[model samples]
Target chain A: MRTARNIGYILGLPVLLVLVWWLSTLGSVNFFVPKPADLVETFGEVWFGDRFFSDVLPSLGRLVVGVAVAILIGVVGGVLIGSVRWLRALLEPTLEFFRAIPPPVLVPVLMLLMGITDSMKVMVIISGCVWPVLLNTIEGVRAVDPVLSDSAHTYGISGWARVRYLVLPSASPQIMAGVRQSLSLGLILMVISEMFASSSGLGFTIVQFQRSFAIPEMWSGIVVLGLLGVAMSFIFQWAERNILRWYHGQKEVENAA
Target chain B: MSPGTLAAGGAAPPKERQRRKAGKGAAKQLLGILGIIGFLATWELIPRLGLIDERFLPPASEVIAALVVDFGLTAFWVAVGETMKAWFLGLLMAVAAAVLLGFIIGSSDFLRKATNSTIEFLRPIPSVALIPLAVLLFGVKIESSLLLIVYASFWQVLIQVLYGVADVDMVANNTAKTYGLGRMARIRYVVFPTALPYLMTGVRLAAAVALVLAITAELVIGSPGLGREIALAQSGGAISGMYALVLATGLIGVLINMLMRQIEKRILGWHSSIRSEVIV
Candidate 1:
């Protein structure tokens, strides 16, 4: 009963929002922003049609490939620099410097050099996503309690074993947080890159629809993208909770203590 | 929490700490300088050796020369001035609106709970994706760019403020209330100051996002800015010119970030994260 009440409470806000959306567009208001029902119909058309799968698949493929590559590179590089005090000192500022430069600023030059290809889009996503993961991994490594390290050292665990057994688990939660952030950033850049060029993808579809003044279709694209963002975030949160149950349990223990 | 506790935490031997300190000092300085030198040398030597196309990869010397020579150009300065104007204006509005809204939502538990899902739903929608809508409404103008910047920045800062306020220590709030403080007074004296670190972090994050959106607006709209300059230089076949501008823009971004950090440190000197030595 309590769970049902909580679920109802959770669902209440979106219902209110949808109601508002319906009310606002019932009269002859701004026509550009289509009604919620219209958007739903358009969404149905796209989802049931071939146009949706082709666009979504390529975008999802790019997103998975881009984020995976970024994670591998960022984690490896971050671990190296972070574990070695000397390397961390040397590379930290440079990393921070590039991290600050708006990734989109690099997009035009990338287009010039690479010319609107899959490789260029992948490169953009990698560069954008890598920084947060790398920085967070470094912070996570640094944040490991020295007492734990000392305890491990007492047991003669050093080198790779130390990292795998002690450091990695300790840092996993923070690193996952960074990965979540990177995923969102990668998604943003993926769409932007496509919006800048591509002949397909949801972003391209939106642009194409907007250009043709297919307002309903354009609204549908925007609504779908927004929903995709929310859905992916929910998925990531669920994964995090599942994978980091230990971390959550630890928190509960700390609170009890 | 106490001085005695903190002193006990630092109970490691001085000699070992001294050695670590010296090692850290040397490494930090060496790496920082080495990083700049390595990048400069790569830029200078790589193109000069004809490995990459000179036109596309312009040597460091030529890039530096462009910065110096083109510094006086009306067009370049205009672009910089215009972009900065939009960024600052949009950032100001975002900060103001976000703080106001954040305060309202943060203060009321029921309302905050009611709106929580709505906020979360809107927050994840990449502000950049709204570019089509923005263009449709306002055309390719500064107004559209500024609106997007404000939109993006508001979500970030508002959320930060919300979390910051929510995370305020319960004991601290109760103590203030025990002193007979009213709602506004309690908030002003206790909540805002406690949230300063979070607020600063939000501003810092917003700064980076604002720069991205500002450049993106220029890229998409073909307006005048560093992004426009790069686009123009690329399209005009002035590859070297494009490279030079890109380097300059990168340097400018670095400088802004460093400056913001410096200011954050100065203003929040009492914050442990700013004043205390790093853990590693």
Candidate 2:
């Protein structure tokens, strides 16, 4: 009975919202707002075919690549800067300045340098997604317990082994947090990059549909984008759970105490 | 949602270290200045040395020169004004709506529970996804920018406010109740103070998101702003001018962030986090 109530609490409002939307739009001739049923039908028709391969997949692929590169660069660079006080001090101000610049503004700059290409879009994503991960990793590395490092040093664990065995594990939790932020940011940049001077991709296709007054198709495209976001977040959570299992268990123990 | 934590994380290194390393602080500042100069020198040299195409990547001096010229132009100021107008209005609307709704929903357990799933579902939908909808609704007007900015920043602030409200001290609340304080009185005295820090953090993150969306809507939708100017400069082959406008946007972003941080510090002066930071 409690489980049923919980489910109701979770799903009730969304169901009610859908019902309201359906009821209100029934037989309505609104140009912008499509009937819920029509949108569902259009969503499947528009996305579950050739467009999926050509536009959706490519967009997802770019996001994956961009985020992957960002994580690699962010983690590597962050670890270096975080471990070195002078280097961190030297780079922090510059990194902060770049982070302040809205990433979308770089779309034009990248477009100018790289032309209308996938690399440009990926670059745009990297430019935006790198900051959070980089900054957070630096903080995480710096925040590593002094005792742990002291013991590691006493054991003669230095160089790459120290970073791999000691620093990386300690910093994994914060790195994951940064990665999560980057994933969403990467998705945003992916869409924005596509929206500018693009011939194909989900963003372009949506804008194309809107410009051509295919209102239902445009709405359907947005639903796909939303679903993509939900799916990416789910995937990240799953990966995070696996990667940071020890961290979570430790956190739980600490909280319980 | 995470940007607040992100900012805090960036600022989190213990201040006591700075005091201890008083001599090192000056060296750090000098190194930071050197770092910027080194970066600028690298930028200036790459094109001049013919390592990269000068047209594609103009010298830093030329871009700065162009930026200076832009500072003198009324049209540039007008674009900046438009972008700021969208950002300010959208941020204000989003913060107001989020605060009001957050309190209403956060105060009631059943309401919070019911809305949780819906909010989660809606929040992940990137505001840029609604560009089509915004354009369809308002065309290329500032409303397009406003719609995107408000939608994007609303979720940022709303989620923070919800968390803030939830964080109200149970002991303080019950004490207020025991003292025969009315709901309004308790909320005004107890809940508002507790939530102010969270709200400030929300507003800070929202400000960044608002600027991003404002620029985006202008860039993509052909609205009147610096973003559109950048696009025009790009298409018109004014490479240095384009870079200059981009630099201006960066400067504005830095200023907005600094302004938000100052506001947060001032408003949250009595909060433990700020107090600890100050004491350190």
Tens-digit per-residue lDDT, A1-257, candidate 2: 99999999998999999999999998789888999988989998999999889999999899998999999999999999999998988888888888888889899899878888888898999889999899999999999999999999999999999999999999999999899878878888898899887999999999999999999999998898898888887888899999999999999999789
Instruction: List the TM-score for candidate 1's chain B.
Output: 0.87
Residue lDDT tens for model 1, A10-113: 78888987898899889955769788877788889975689767898788788889899999888888778788887787778778777777777666667766
Consecutive 10-residue window with the lowest summed lDDT within model 2 chain B: B1-10
TM-score of each model, in listed order: 0.91, 0.94
True contacts kept of each: 0.60, 0.73
Task: Give a tens-digit lDDT track for model 1, residues B1-280.
Answer: 7544664578676558779889978878888889877877887998899987776677888878877776878888888887888788888899899888888888888768877878888988777678778778888778888977898888889999998888788998999999999999988988898888888888888887787788777777655587778778878988767777776667777877887788788888887887564333
In candidate 2, residue B72 scores what lDDT? 98
TM-score of 2: 0.94
Candidate with maximal DockQ:
2
Q: lDDT for model 2, on a 0 to 1 scale?
A: 0.91
Candidate 1 clashes between residue pairs 3 or more apart in a chain or in different chains: A90-B31
Candidate 2 lDDT at B198 equals 90
lDDT of 2 at A153: 99
Best by TM-score: 2
